[model samples]
Every structure is written in C-alpha cells, then in structure tokens.
Target: MRFALSAFAALSLSSAAFANTLESSAGALNITPMVTGLDAPWAVDFVPDGGFLVTERDGDLIYIADGTATRVAGVPDVAARGQGGLLDVTVAQDFAQTREIFLTYAKPQSRGAGTALTVARFSEDGTALENSREIFEAAPGFSGGRHFGSRVVEAQDGTLFVTIGDRGNRPSAQDRSNHNGAVVRINRDGSVPDDNPFVGQSNVQPEIWSYGHRNPQGAGLDLEGRLWTSEHGAQGGDEVNLVQRGANFGWPVISYGEHYGGGRIGEGTEKAGMEQPAYYWDPSMAPSGLMVYSGALWPEWRGDIFVGSLKFDYISRLDGGGVTEVEQIEGDATSRVRDIVEASDGSIWFVSVGDGAIYRITPG
Candidate 1:
C-alpha cells in the first residue's frame, strides 16, 4: 500500500515535525516525510515493483521500503570531492522485464574527474547491479571537481540525454571538440545516435546535441517530450532554458549575471547569435532539480514547473513558456533541496540534502 496521506492527520494537529499542512488554492497541502537519516542525497527515483531508490553524493545507492533503508551494492568509485559524487538515477523504460537502470556521476579521472553515464542491470533480489558499463564519458577531464553537471534523462524514443558542466573552464564551453558544457545524446549500449546534431561533423564530438552551457544540474522532459534544464550561474545569472537539438545556448558570452568579483560577463548579457534563456534569476536561485507538473494530484497545478532552489532553501514554481515565478513554497527547516519528482500516485517528492531526508507534498 502507498502512503495513506490525508489532510486530517497533517492539518488537525499543529506539528511541523515531519509533515506540514499549508493552505493552497485548491486545498490544503500535507507535506510528509518518507525517509530520514540520509547522507547528502542527490537524486531519487521509484522502482517498478515497489520501493524507491536514492543516490547519496558520498558514493552510496540506497533502497528504502517499509521504514528500512538498505545499501545497494556495485556503485562505482566516485571522486566524492567538491560537488562530484554519486548523482542521478533512473529506472529503465522497460524496467519490469529488463530490470535495468541508468546512472550518472563524477567519474574519477587522472586529471581530476569528469561526468560519466552508464546503464546496469539489477540483480534478481535487488541486492546489486550487474553488467555495469560506461556508456558515455565527458572529454577533457579537468581538475577541481567544481561543476560536473551530471544528470541523465531518457527520451521517448529510447535515447538518452546527458548533461556536462563547464568544469570551471569557461572557454571550453564554446569549443565543440570537448564534451564539457554540453548535452550529449546516445543509445542504450554506449552507441551514438545517427541523428545527433554533430554526428557527421568534423573535429566536433558526434555525441554533442547542444553546446555553450555553464553547469546544468537539473534535466526534465516536459509533457510534450521536450527537454528542459535548470543551470547554475557564476554569481547571479542562474537560468532555466528550454534545451533544443543543435542549439547554441550562450554561456560566458551572453549572461544576465556578472563575474564572481563583479564585472560584466560575456559582452554584457546579449549576443548576436546566442539563444536567450526562457527565464532567469538576477540574484540566482542556485537551481538543481526540475519537474514539469503533470497536475495529477492537484488539477489546478496542471502545467506549472517546480524546481529545487539550492541557495534559496525553498521550491520555486513557474508557469508556462514565459517561465515566470508564480509561487515559492518554503520548507519548515532550512534545506539545500537537491532533486524533485512527481510520484506515481500523484504526490510531489523531493530530497533535501541539508536536511538529510525525503519529503512528499500531497493534497490534503
């Protein structure tokens, strides 16, 4: 049985301990805790049969069910330094039969580390992953694990899209030769898709679908199957972009934010041929995970966009194509919210890294 989440239990008594009851347009929202005592959890995804899977940035994969959290084996060695370590995890499209899952993280490299994407099959008893193989590894691995931008999303056509960061190298984002600061498209078994933007190009990496990015941490597919991302800016230029195939998203060249110490970034925010962000925050939200609301639980929230604000300690809700911020839901405790997803039963779930717990928001 799923969580018997009701508004009465959460709203009747005044306790902000685990669940919080708040008033909304449609009705009361009951925010309940699913699990606790996690160590810097980065991403969470549900399994086909039962339970949910979570990844810890310190290089651990956990399975939580019936109030028990078990460590799943076969996680690769991650750098676990700076902001690099175990990251996003997603169950395969055909997980029931194939029992496969996809993962992304900062792969330990000689230079320092780079983001790597892989697919693996889970054991029959769900104890360990088998046949793990690296499907794609970002090029020109750099030192200092500042921005790995490791997030993987599967497309409706069975292809995968992986996000790579600038690796603290601003100019590398403009170079098509390296995989840094770009989105890559690949097949399930580490093969390149023929229809990729630069597949037939010379000198450019064939896997690159889009280039000129800073550090995109959150990747989500909208209801229309289009890819959307939330990226962190240097100081004050945090952005949300509608990722397009072969599109050139302006990074250091055209940004709404300035440099760290206070100078104009990249020609003062507007360029001749660079794509503008769908929406941006001047002071920065430090956005991480993104989700396009399906309106399953609350019908009024049909097409809204929800994002985890790392620096702001709250959830920002945006509306439609304009990407305007419509609402901000704050948690009881100060939390560096990491990942967000809509549960199958129509509940909104997210992982708070600073709080070290998982919470679900459902209509009360």
Candidate 2:
C-alpha cells in the first residue's frame, strides 16, 4: 500500500503578496510562489493534467496539485550524496495516452554511484508509479560524490537523450568505453539506436551520441528542434553548447577557463576536431536547467534561451542563437535556481533550491 506523504503546504502567493518585481531587459517580470518548503528540490516537470512532478535531491519525488504536495511512490533508490541523487524528470510526449515518464538518478554501484536512466508508468490516480524499470546506467561508477550530469530530453523522433558527467575524472570524458561525460541516445526500452554515431564501433559505448562534456546539468530542444546543453566549467568556463552527433567537446583538452587556482587548462581554447561552445561565461555562474522559449505569452522572447543559475540567484536569458546573454531575470525569489522550464500556457516556471520553493514568472 502506497502512502501520500505531505511534503509541504502549497503556498500559492497572490500577486499582491509577491512584492519583488523581477529585473529584466524586456520588462519588469512578476514572480509568484507556487509551492514552498521543499527540501533541496532539483528538477520539476508539468503533468499533462495540470499538476507538477518535482524531484528532490535527497531521493524524494513530490507531486503538487491543487495546493497539496504528495510524495509519489515507486521512485528507485538513489545514491543521494554530493551532487548525486534523484536528478531530472520528464513526461513522455504522449503522456495523456501512455502515462509514461522518464527519470535520471544516481544509481548506487559497487564502486560508488553513477548516473542512470529509468522509465515508468504513472498510475491513473497519480499517486504511484505502476511499472518501473531501469533503462541505462553510466559505466564504472566512481567513488567520490561529485559531477553527475543527469538530464533527459526527448528528441523529435521519440528517442531519449540522456546526459552524464565525467564523475570528477577528467580523462573519462575522452574515453569511448564508458558513458561518462557523454550524451547518449537510446530507445524507450534502453536499446541503443542503430543510427547512433558510435553504434557498431569497436571499443565504444554504442549509445553515445556525443562526448567530452564536463558536467552538463541542463539540456533542452529549441524551436527548430535543435538540442542545446548548459555546462559547468572548472572555475570560470561555464558554457552553452549546441550538442552535435559524435562531436567531441573539448573539456580537459581545451577550455576557455583555467584551473581553479588559476593556470592554463589545455593547449588553447581552439583545437582541431573539438567543437566550440556557442556561448560561455568567463566567471562561472554554475548554470543548471535550460529551456528554449516558444514566445507563446511573450512574442519577443520566441526562440530565446533561459538558463537557471545555481551559483548566482537569477535566470540568464540568452539570445535566440544561444550566443549571447541578453538578459538576467533576477529578484528576491530568484534564489539558487536549479531548474527552469516553459509551461504549456507559456508561463515560465523554475525551481529554487535556496528558497525551497517553486516560482512562476510572468510579464509584469
């Protein structure tokens, strides 16, 4: 028997109660609190029927509806340590008909823990997960508890794109034998797509779509269906990149930023065969969740990109091409934004780990 654990009282703040107006280049943005008192919430995605599925890094999945936050059952055990834990959640494209969802977590392993992907069906009542299964696990789980790049994005063709971090092992990003620091494309059942770049290649993980990322915590598709990732640099090289097929993104090899204590990182910023970042931050902001806007509510923002900042308490709005930081949506509520997404109604929603709440942003 599953239980409905009350995570917190959903504090739906009225417009008058939300005092701080967000600073933005476009205009003053209004932010309202939707839910409060969450415990280290990491990611959030909308349910097809007008609710939210939120993942807490401490291994809890909470569902908020009509001012009540209930804990959902059947989430897999996660290695909730350091940056590892229940990471990301996304509903299926045909969620109303299929009731399917995808989750990424830090799966406990013999060595330590590794990022993993799972597929499950939500119950009709939204109280429990009916069928749960692990689809993929990044190889050779390292011991230390840092750098688990675990974001899931559904491609246009219904395939899944899962991201993994280097697990603090810089050299692993260049290794073909493991899934570390790589983007993998796989089928619904965890099968490798035959057309994947590394498929059929010797000594390579067949599921890899791209490699050499440092720690891509956020990923999303643009209006044209192009995939983009927001990655963290060691000290200052935080970047946004257009992920490509089998392309090598220079990590330890070449970086625009230097070492933490200040030293040249690689041969140089530009290198042969390695892909360059679309945009980068010289002073790392620790970017997390990513979303490409459709401009349904704000026509001017169509095709623009929104990125949540974990280190800085704000959302960085990038230009349509993902090449420039055009705006910084900041306010009192914009505290340690861990995830950001565009809702069905065109309103922007984000998860704030620092505030322990979920906030909705709209044009003021």
lDDT of model 2, residue 152:
99
Give the 10-residue window scoring lowest on summed lDDT in candidate 1.
1-10
Give the per-residue lDDT of model 2 (tens digit) for 1-364: 3333333432444545743576677688778777777789999999989799999999988887876667888999999999999999999999989999999999999999999999999887778887899999888658789889979999999999998889999999999899888999999899998899988889999999999999999999998898999999998999999999999998889998889888998887989999999999989999999999999989899999999999989899998853699888887888999999989999999999998888888888
Cα lDDT of model 1 overall? 0.85
Clashing pairs in 2: none
Report the backbone clash tally of model 1.
0
TM-score of each: 0.94, 0.96
Q: What's the distance in Å from true for residue 36, model 2?
A: 0.7
- For residues 1-364, what per-residue lDDT tens digits would candidate 1 score against the true structure? 1222223244324435656787666678888777766778999999978889999999988876654456788888888999999999998889999989999999888888999987899777777889899888888558897889978999999999998889989998999989989999999988998899888788999999998889999989988988989999988889888999999898878899888899888887878778899889879989999999898888778877888999989888888656888888885632888999988898999989887877888877
Q: Whose TM-score is greatest here?
A: 2
Most accurate candidate by lDDT = 2
Relative to the true structure, how large is the alpha-carbon lDDT of every model? 0.85, 0.89
